[model samples]
Target: MRRSQRKQEEPDLGVLAGRTLFGLQRELFTRLGEVGHPDVRPRHGAVLAYLDEEGSRATDLAAQSGQHKQVIGTLVDELVELGYVRRQPDPADRRAKLIVPTDKGLDHMAKSDAILAGMEAEHARAVGEEAYAEFKRVFRLVADRHSGR
Candidate 1:
């Protein structure tokens, strides 16, 4: 069939991935709102995604999240004000500060983890665990390829 003549039944893979993630984030934000974080937004997910259990410097987070230092700094300030994250002097370097998740942030992380786990379990049940595992492996391979690993 000619390119123009062929019907497009679904979005391309990139669109599918972006839309699916957006939907998941919407669901997460809604759940968080229900759990007492009505102010949390998907934009903050960029900062939250890079934060570790131990903590990291704002520059590192900005690099990982592909955001400007000023932007990440502002987001960190907001997160601090919201009680989701705190800035503490980095022991390794006093000149730098580490962005650490507060107890509230960790609790939110736990809840978010549970929500994703439930979604994964539901997907596995629908697709079969073996198939789901294979899918995960394939996805990882694709990611590794993109990362030149």
Candidate 2:
């Protein structure tokens, strides 16, 4: 193939991957909402997921979530208002506060996990199991490399 044609034919894999992942996440969140869960924005979900994995200070969550501290603090305030999370005095630093998920937040995560499992099953069915497995493996490899892990 001519160099121009070869270059033209090269896949925009990054864009494709981003679109697919975002679509899947949107669909999963939509299904979750349909199941009567409050409409939490994707950013809030990221915050909740992060807190679930490891409770951290608002600044840490801001950095990890790629959101500004003000943005994260606002989101945390919303979560607290919704009774999904709480801010407690940090033992490591008396002046800092740690974000912790409430029982409600944990329960929401359990429900979200079930919804995500169903979505994953559908995705595997749509893209054959082998393809899904390979995609996951390759994606993880790329992620690990990018993160220097």
Candidate 3:
């Protein structure tokens, strides 16, 4: 087979998938900024997504995000300064503080969900609903198996 045909037959899906996901993430961040969250950084996403409804401590955020406590603490501080999160006395630990999302943060989370839904709908339209469903299923399977879930 010709080199061009061989390349077409076995495209690098890893690169393509990564580019697609990150491209969407970039767009989401841009949209967030356009909607008045100019301070929200891409690095803050892991903490925000994993934050519990009640609240979480820096250590907990670190555990959930697979980051160091100091890194999570720094991100939490940034969130606090941005008015997205507030630190309150931790009921579990008197010396530590719990980070809770403010009303603005909750609104941003809701908007983020809507943005994701819109992107998924676009993917479905492009590849057909059934293909999109299969794609999601495959990704979930890979993630679950990879994570030993």
Candidate 4:
């Protein structure tokens, strides 16, 4: 095969997928800023959402968010300092701690949801509502399959 043909045959799916996802994340974060939640970044938002949904330990959040434990710990500390979240002693396991979002965190979550809803509406407008819904369904299926869930 010619060089060009070989290049075409070797699709860099991993690179392309990562670039696409990163681009979308950047765009979403920009929109979030526009929506007046400028202080919240994608990573912080992910941690908040995880705590809101599952209320896991710091170690678990680190694993689930694919962030280093120390990184998550630092972020959690920041969140705590900002009064968005608090760490309380776990009743079941005294030695362990459970991270819970404060009222401020919940408020932030509501704003984040509003921003994401606006983004989703824009996406539906661009791609059609039905198509967007189907895309989400298929994407979730693919994600679940890959994660063995």
Candidate 5:
């Protein structure tokens, strides 16, 4: 059949991925706001999602998030201004600064973890646990391909 004559029954992979990511982020941020971290946004996920409980270097966050160091720095700055994180000297490396979560950030992190778990559980329930597990496995493989993992 010619392209114009063919029916578009389903979205392509890129569309599906974009839709999924946007939907997930929308739900996450909305939930976060309800829990009092209204300043958290999807763009901050690059730093927030990869942050460690102790602390993390901006460079490390950049590598983990697949963002540039400068971008990570900017996000850290924003988070700092939002009172979610602070820059402190790394105990292991005096020359480097670590992005440490404030008390508010810690609370936000804990809430975020619970919310994401609940979301995943809901998805698993909808799709069946085994199918959801398989879906995650496949998605991870596809996503990690770009990271050379």
Candidate 6:
């Protein structure tokens, strides 16, 4: 079979997931740029998406974001420089620091939440709410099963 013909076959789960993730990230970052966060890049999502309002430790963020601790540290430093996050002493442990989002980061987080909701609504509308819900449920189950979580 020709390479072109092989390429035309239905995509495997990895290809489909990667393509979907790419599209979602592109749309999300573009929308975020329009909302006064032009400096926020797709890579920043690794930190922002997993962050909590109360703040979290670098180790926790690294585990949640599936990024190396060094990478998380670099991203946190960049965010601090960008005025999106600040490091504060962890109340529970004076020896540890917590990554807390600034006001700008909170605003960005709200906007991102709304934009993602709208995107999900659009998809649900296109494919029916029930079907979309089922798709998400199945996808999450498979993801969890593979991740051993």
lDDT of 1 by residue, 29-67 (tens): 898888877887888877887789899899999887778
Clashing pairs in 3: none
Report each candidate's C-alpha RMSD, comma-separated, in the order given.
2.5, 3.7, 3.1, 3.5, 2.1, 1.2
Which numbered prediction scores highest in lDDT against the true structure? 6
| TM-scores vs. true structure, each candidate | 0.85, 0.77, 0.81, 0.74, 0.93, 0.96
User: Which residue pairs collide, candidate 4?
Assistant: none
Q: Per-residue lDDT tens digits of candidate 4, residues 6-65?
A: 656874656556776787778777876776556777678557767754356998887677
Candidate 5 residue spans exceeding 4 A from truth = 1-8
lDDT of 5 by residue, 15-131 (tens): 778989999999999999998999889999999899998999999999999999999999999999999999999999999999999998899999999999999999999999999
Q: Report every candidate's CA lDDT.
A: 0.85, 0.79, 0.84, 0.77, 0.93, 0.93
Q: Please, what are the lDDT tens digits per residue for candidate 6 over residues 69-137? A: 999999999999999999999999999999999999999999999999999999999999999999999
- Model 3 poorest 10 in a row by lDDT: 7-16
Q: Candidate 3 lDDT, tens digit per residue, 60-90? A: 7887677889888888888888888899999
- Residue by residue across 8-91, what tens digits does model 2's lDDT show? 587466766778778977986787677766567677865776674446898888766767899999999998988888999988
Candidate 2 least-lDDT 10 residues: 46-55
Question: CA lDDT of 75 in candidate 6?
Answer: 96
Best-fitting candidate, measured by TM-score?
6
- Model 5: lDDT equals 0.93
Clashing pairs for predicted structure model 2, backbone only: none
In angstroms, how far off is 65's CA in candidate 1? 2.6
Q: Candidate 3 vs candidate 6: which has greater lDDT?
A: 6
TM-score of candidate 1 to 2 decimals:
0.85
